[model samples]
Target chain A: MTNAPIFERMALIGIGLIGSSLAQAARQRGLVKEIAISTRSEATLRRAEELGLGDSYSVDAAVAVEGADLVILCVPVGANEAIAKWIAPALKKGAILTDAGSTKGSVVAQVAPHVPEGVHFIPGHPIAGTEQSGPDAGFPTLFDQRWCILTPPENTDPDALEKLKAFWQGCGSDVDLMDPKHHDLVLAIVSHLPHVIAYNIVGTADDLEAVTKSEVIKYSASGFRDFTRLAASDPIMWRDVCLNNKDAILEMLARFSEDLSALQRAIRWGDGDKLFEMFTRTRSIRRSIIEAGQETDAPDFGRHSGD
Target chain B: MTNAPIFERMALIGIGLIGSSLAQAARQRGLVKEIAISTRSEATLRRAEELGLGDSYSVDAAVAVEGADLVILCVPVGANEAIAKWIAPALKKGAILTDAGSTKGSVVAQVAPHVPEGVHFIPGHPIAGTEQSGPDAGFPTLFDQRWCILTPPENTDPDALEKLKAFWQGCGSDVDLMDPKHHDLVLAIVSHLPHVIAYNIVGTADDLEAVTKSEVIKYSASGFRDFTRLAASDPIMWRDVCLNNKDAILEMLARFSEDLSALQRAIRWGDGDKLFEMFTRTRSIRRSIIEAGQETDAPDFGRHSGD
Candidate 1:
């Protein structure tokens, strides 16, 4: 199941978590002959060089994309448009241009217009990450057993799309094809809404006048610790997600709020049957997620295994 | 660091996750000389016996409590009253009667009146568990490095409290004491609200018309899977928590909803700065939780370690 080099030269536009992981995965799996990495941050570019993440590293994204047959925009979703406009002229003819943004519709809306006529613009989201960020936070196995959803534009070259899919598979990811708008909607519920709720709940706990923060920290293992992992994610990235996918996120938020109000009502009225029914039904989703191999079956995510 | 048998005979009134874990923990640590187990369900009692979780098993709470020096009510918070009344006469003189329920105030309210003379009734909550339940879910290490908070009445004998604390320490948990009401409030934020929010979000995802359940399941690794762990907790226990700790849970839910509304408005208005600031501040709490040893520092709760 090993892959030959799918692209002679692959350019990475940001050397953050996703970028660094992609570089390592591609190199380890021989997915690309050469990798040229660029980030706007001088320290990050320097760190990428120090880590030997690619064959070439540069602060100027335009220089890195020169002659690169495959270019991936790995910065936050909000940073895609400027990078797209900056590198469009330097893109190789017949090159496949893609992104690893969390929101495909937003990435498409931002970067599609700037893509060169001959470039293949396919937006994608790898549904994998940790709370940590930066080049230092990535490992080659980050995408192992994870789903990477690609939203290739209409009229996209089938060969180019297939090549991109193979590239992701080479990096140890299961590739899924989805429409850009539908991808946004799905991510809005699965990712964006969860992050927003986690942030909101953590904020609520922090603002509590009645309960001390020390108490919250000391007893978090009961449940709050789980949400904190999502809450502790990169702020700038999540803020961008909130801004870029506003419509779908807000719709999911509305539904969540409506559901919370109903749960609140059940508690206030002591409707044990209603509360039990709601809690009972939600358990099946976790089982389904585990059966899908998207989640570990180990208890507490096996966080306590070290004990 | 180790304990001799603290109690000659210990009675467990439920054989679910917490009860079975307690039986194993106490037996493995030599905290009790003999263990007696009971539950309303005859099948569960038979399963408990087959698992060798205790020296004696009974469906009769009274029969299990006879001659036991310590008795723990480990049923759902809502079931405490009837169990208390049934076991009150059988409880040995000077026995320490405690509970492993999540909500302290509710346990105290439900079980205190049924306490017989000379029986020390302390409401305790061990902030440890997985999404799994039943006798087979029990493990000796379940409570290791976790917190067990005991809320003893003001007039209670100090020796009984100390002995109960020692028993939990034998089970490998640190002990903290708080007023029952304060314990309820603290738990409402750290445990109850988180579970409530998780259940609400999972239910909302289930009821979505636009997104298919298969889609949510396939892509849950992004964030939705974290909440699913809490949402998959025992329904009866959570139902009782809502019914019993109504006021504190309601207050926390109100705060969570209010903060969520503000987050929604920020998303609607596209206020990236506000979202960033809120998201940034919450990161510190998670750091504190990790530093305080309340959470695993490993990213994604080390769920991806297997990959």
Candidate 2:
């Protein structure tokens, strides 16, 4: 663990899975000297307090940001503008304000206008999560071996950028700096499109009256179970992601639909070779993911020993 | 364990994951008096013999079924007709011949004509399997607490049906009898379609030139890795499933594409409500699956101990 503190105080404006995880990681490695948590709901704020996620908890966003050297907007992407407006006045001079939003461009656009001249605005996304949400859904090692992409504007202060990168490094993440637009595009194909497809398929299976609901549940082992986990993600969070990342999501969806149409035609024409080729090609991508160490090579259910 | 033998000699015609699992389950519980195994490939037969999955092993299907009272065809669906013809002459009088093919109606259509008179043909499918395959993948508890659906012909012998049902029960499966057409339809939606969609998405992602493939691999934790596991399934087996179960698969594919189109439009129009409702509903299906014990409630990699 790094002995040097990354920030004097860190303000987290939503103590959900990402925020609580950041808190846990920060405290475990002494990345920050103190943490303040704020959320719209008092119950969630109380829960964060119960979990010892921060030194202070409040429902008022501005109150939480006061005196904090680092402020992270950990709310859903849709709430970014409102949270930014609320905290803009209380943000400390020369403080670094970042985010853990899924959609980078929208977050940059929404929060950039509210940033005071001295504060550094770096939009970041920590590419890690579970199906579960809330303060209890966090762990100290959640960011270990994960990637955190920082989409800092070209004119951002160099010192602030370096300090923020140090914080993520202390949280056990390898940082990648990229343009916000490119980050959104990359995420659309890898994350947003997959979630939309999963949600749609689960909804389609749910609407099937001919196939008894129980039967779908009973036989989900084949392939549907994989989609179910992604589909079961927080609805509010996903909704905001789709609404915010529209252009890139649509472009990826268009390519996916085009490919799916080709597959459908092959299946209709009984093109065994085409189907076999596609299925065969996909297997190598999975092998690459396993080799990259981003995913476990374990059999189903092997990695969640404690959970 | 059931002490009464269901068949004098039970012949498993292919000693892959399903075949070897069935052999292990039967032997552990003494469901058969003797076991005979065979495969067209000499290597697979040797592997099965080394694993001691049967009392005897043969390269010729006819040789393995010579004295067998029950012959279970465990090869891929594509090989059903060929294996049925090869072993037809050697099958004992009044033998009950069944299969563990994924697509029941196609297997019935292909294999029924080759079955000789006095031999009862009862095609069945056990709704159980892992991503793994071959004799080395077999485990004694593979079938425990799983569903096994039998799609016997309407006029098939009652005694033969009962014997097959008892056999599946002894192998640790709860048996459900359904019409062959309905079984195919149900499986197309539940199993076949999901695998096809997974394979397609993984292929789509792999073909992208804009995003470096390494980026996709590194960030797979954002839901792409889940699909990779399903996409990594055996290509030949899935190809056979796609070809043998053509009509039903095509039907489900059409529905999936249509649903996906609606979802694509929702994302395009920034309809957060529609996305939220679809995402929320899908979560309930996952909850029901977990409650029904069809899947583990543990974290993604936590459920299975072996990788």
Best by DockQ: 1
Please write out the lDDT profile of model 2 over residues B1-307, one tens digit for every residue. 6577888999999999899999999998999999999898999899888889999989988999998899999988999999988899998888999999899988989999999999999988888777767898778777777889998887889999999999998888889999988888889988998888888888788878888798899888888888888888888889899888889888888888888888888888888788887788778898998898777776554422222
Q: Per-residue lDDT for B1-307 in model 1, tens only?
A: 3567899999999999999999999988899999999999999999999999999988899999999989998999989999998999888999999999988887877789989999999889999999999999889989988999999999989999989999999999999999999999999999999999999999999999989999999999999999999999999999999998899999888788888888889999998889989999999999999999888888888876777
Candidate 1: pairs in clash? none
Poorest lDDT segment (10 consecutive residues) of candidate 1 chain B: B298-307
Best by TM-score: 1
Residue A258 CA error for candidate 2 (Å)? 1.0
Q: Kindly report which residue pairs in candidate 2 clash with one another.
A: A299-B307, A300-B304, A301-B302, A301-B303, A301-B304, A302-B304, A303-B301, A303-B302, A304-B302
State the displacement of the C-alpha of residue B79, model 2, in Å, after optimal TM-score superposition: 1.0
Question: How large is the interface RMSD of each prediction?
Answer: 0.7, 1.5
Tens-digit lDDT track of model 2 for A90-187: 99999999999999999988999999989999999999888888899887888878899999898888999999999998888899999988888889
